[model samples]
Target: MLFYRAALPLSRKTLTFVAGIIRRHRASIGSCWRKLNPGQQALLVLAHLRKGETLAELAAGFGVGVTTAWRYVNETVALLAARAPKLRRAVRDAKKAGYAYVVVDGTLIPIDRVAADRPFYSGKHKKHGMNLQVIASPGGDILWVSGALPGSVHDKKAEWIWGVLAELEAAGLVTLADKGYLGSTYAKIPYRGKNKPESQKQANKAHAKLRAPAERANAQLKNWRILRKLRCCPWRAGQLAKAIHVLQIREA
Candidate 1:
């Protein structure tokens, strides 16, 4: 009843990560995602985010239509979100097993007018609408992802650190983030004991150092042409994150 499991040549890191996830959220994965073909589901999800594919493009690529492609993307995203508790637990376990020190940030995806009209964003992109806010580990594994918000919405305005920190706290892990997340309240240990200006500067320095790995991780993600382009809708972005995470874990 394995809904999704990686194929052979599984890297030690990937096998460990998957095993941890399965151990932590055995119930949810079995209950919800058991019906779907893990390979097709993973491919379909990745196709949406991969560069050079519109809904129409995806339809043609998968030999379907725009409508059907959209349906699959939505359904898959909904399924993942529904099983968020399990995913969260998996991420928590990974952190506990020395994968702590997460990198938190957000990205935007552009959408056309028809999709733009939906409530996905509070505000719209200049011409294309956007899906905002994704928090991932250094290996590109998503810790938590927020609902699609307006492109105009600033990362700071979203205040995702609190929730992300809470999850980390519950998991007993520490966090590392960029300046965008400064002043954010989460499961963080702030640096102390420097003079006023120096203290602030030192905090910034520390954050930068801690965030270095995640920055590199994001760069690696961008190296994948798929993530470079905003082909998928917001929902598909989550799926894309999952696929990338899987790939990263395997490579690791």
Candidate 2:
């Protein structure tokens, strides 16, 4: 056996919070016994997510079989993902936060490879990945992350599929987005097709400025390391994203 040390820059509060979730989950499931306790299991999942540690290394370090480690990660991720807010709840949160408008953005979660080629290929990014739409406050705080869609889905279409614009509008909220959302009523985007008036150009500049800060929401997510590129099933990408969303919200 080989042993080594690695760092996971998460706080003890994060570990304890996750452990509580798993503890209740185990009791609910009537899980009588396990090789690792709730805290250990939480730590293992956090390591995999924050440090991007592979299942093999985690299994070796924790003295568990690879399958057990895989099961722990999946179970914890699913539990966390289930706690993530829905579109309606998210908008209501924005309302409570006294936000008149929210920033909308989309990102690709890269995958090593997939069962299909064209379906997973993002023409815009020129890569294979999953598309996740994010909603952020004006201050760049992430409020929601939509379910994963095929990378081929346009940002405009993905947001439409999530019906975020309609939800926000119904909540009396506005949306600030990029050119991809140009055709929508609420998505305020930059001007199109060159040779515009100075006023229009100035408006576009302001739009870009407003949208720039929201980009941090994407950074907040990808900083977790696991989201930088998913080594797991592409179908699980949304679950992991939602899981991260829940953790980020609670940890904040």
Candidate 3:
């Protein structure tokens, strides 16, 4: 089973990081006898998350039953997410760093449409998925990620629901967002008025230039292919997103 990891192409840094996390996870949980060591289990879960491998394939490759493989992956995801920072803390950090502003944006993560519920249907993207709000520094470092919301929720609504705007407001941290978050007092959004003056259009363009890094940050999150199209339970979307977020921070 360990040989399977060698066969699959992965970077040395990622392999080492996964092994370290697995070692720490095992140490925290105390001694336990299992078919695969912590490193192998970590590799198995990382392959599933980073490679988007299915349970059946992971089970065969890791020499574990499908049920065990699923448990291992979910448990590891939860573990990583537990260490993710809350929105308020992230906002405070930004203020302490003397950042003039942070960027906020909402991204849609495609998921398996297991049901016909309209909530998962995003009219904007015309797809079934969940919305995740992300905040990043001007340099494209992700500062925080909000929990999953129904795809049908508007970007502004999602920001309010996640208390992102409120936190920034309380921390006196300005934020740069797109027109999607038009009404936020703490966020500097592009002018959306119709028939705007040349000055307004120019401001919008400059606003766009500043907000470009947020879009790049969102793209970086989606680079974790498991987030490309989630096939697991929708309730776990937040956990998976947070796990990927923490891993990306480590990469930085």
Query: Which lDDT tens digits does candidate 1 get at residues 1-252?
Result: 123333333345543443344434545556455333444444554445434346676566555567767766665545444545343765556666587577666565555445446554434234444444555666555555455555556566654523555665577666665555556676353454446587677876776666665655555555445556454554455455445555554565
Order of models, best lDDT first: 2, 3, 1
Full ranking by TM-score: 2, 3, 1
- How well does each candidate superpose onto the true structure, as a TM-score? 0.55, 0.96, 0.91
| lDDT, candidates in the order shown | 0.53, 0.90, 0.84
Q: Please report, as a residue range, the 10-residue window in candidate 1 with the lowest summed lDDT.
A: 1-10
lDDT of 2 by residue, 22-118 (tens): 9999999899999999999999999999878899999999989999999999999999999999999999989999986799999999988855678
Q: Enumerate clash totals for all models, in the order shown.
A: 0, 0, 0
lDDT of 3 by residue, 1-252 (tens): 344334444566766776777778878888587777777887888878787888899889878899989888877788889889888788888899998689999999998895577989999999989999999998888899889988999999999988888888888777888888877777888887699999999998988888886678888887778899988877678889898888777776
Which parts of model 1 are misplaced by more than 4 Å? 1-45, 55-91, 112-131, 138-141, 160-162, 170-172, 186-203, 216-252
Report the number of the highest-lDDT candidate. Answer: 2
Which residue pairs in model 1 clash with each other?
none
